[model samples]
Target: MSGLEGCWSAPGQVRGKDATSVLRGEWHLGRRYFVLHLRSVAPAQAYEAAITYRAGEKPGGIGSFWMDTFGGLYEPSLGLGAVSPDGFYLDYHFPDAAYHNRFERRGKGWRWTIVERAPGKPDKLFARYELAPASCRGTTFTF
Candidate 1:
């Protein structure tokens, strides 16, 4: 996790439209864990989420907690995550939506992909946010 203790930016497109997202991660509780704040920037749009990472649920366990703005918009979908050597995975269950997310730090950036699976339907790509150190801000993105 220490390798990711900084800010990253994902300037890409969503639904064929320009989009931007920034992720800031920092150590918490005397470096016992990490808290990541995710923010999105787009014209007349906003999104936010937080992920809490706790090291070693057991001997080699990495646990995570995920919650997002969906709950604030009238749907509470608190989620949990598991991490392997490759990356982290999160699964959420909501009354109306099922979401699965995977994050992998590759080479110099993080690959964040999310999928939405609705009842009686196939899984669909919700979004894929690729994050890397935004050089303009010395590896950080300015709000």
Candidate 2:
């Protein structure tokens, strides 16, 4: 996961697309987690958020803490993830809402996607994040 440390730009953002978002993070809590910050801006709206990701006690699972700018929208959600041979799967299930996400390796970069599912319904893609290396962040996202 050390490869995850650094600045990442979304697709079509090489020309400055704050609306598309730019993500950056570093490790914190004595290497317990990678503290991430994201900023997004558009013509009439803007958003910012932070996330903390930590490896779980076992080999297949991970945990995250998230908080965003939305007023009480997400507040702080504790998310869980599982690792596989190809990539990682994350599920963020809050009351009345559920999201399934995937972070898969794509060459030197990564592909991140999320989908929302309602009870007895099909999954709907909420967002897709294509992260590519923008700059090296020292050595690791380590604290």
lDDT of 1 at 121: 89
Error of 2 at 14 (Å): 18
* Residue pairs clashing, model 1: 71-75
Q: Deviation in angstroms for 42 in model 1?
A: 2.2
Error of 2 at 12 (Å): 7.9
Report, for all candidates in order, the number of backbone clashes: 1, 1
Per residue, candidate 2 scores C-alpha lDDT tens digits across 22-134 of: 67867877887787676663536466678778887788788887787774866688888888676777788877768777778999888877778778777777777788887
How does model 2 fare in lDDT? 0.71
Q: Which ten residues in a row have the lowest lDDT in candidate 1?
A: 134-143
For candidate 2, give the lDDT of residue 57.
70
Which residue pairs collide, candidate 2?
A: 27-141
Instruction: Output the number of the TM-score-best candidate.
Output: 2
TM-score of each: 0.76, 0.81
Model 1 — TM-score against the truth?
0.76
Predicted model with the maximum lDDT:
1
Estimate the Cα RMSD of every predicted model relative to the unseen true structure: 3.5, 4.9
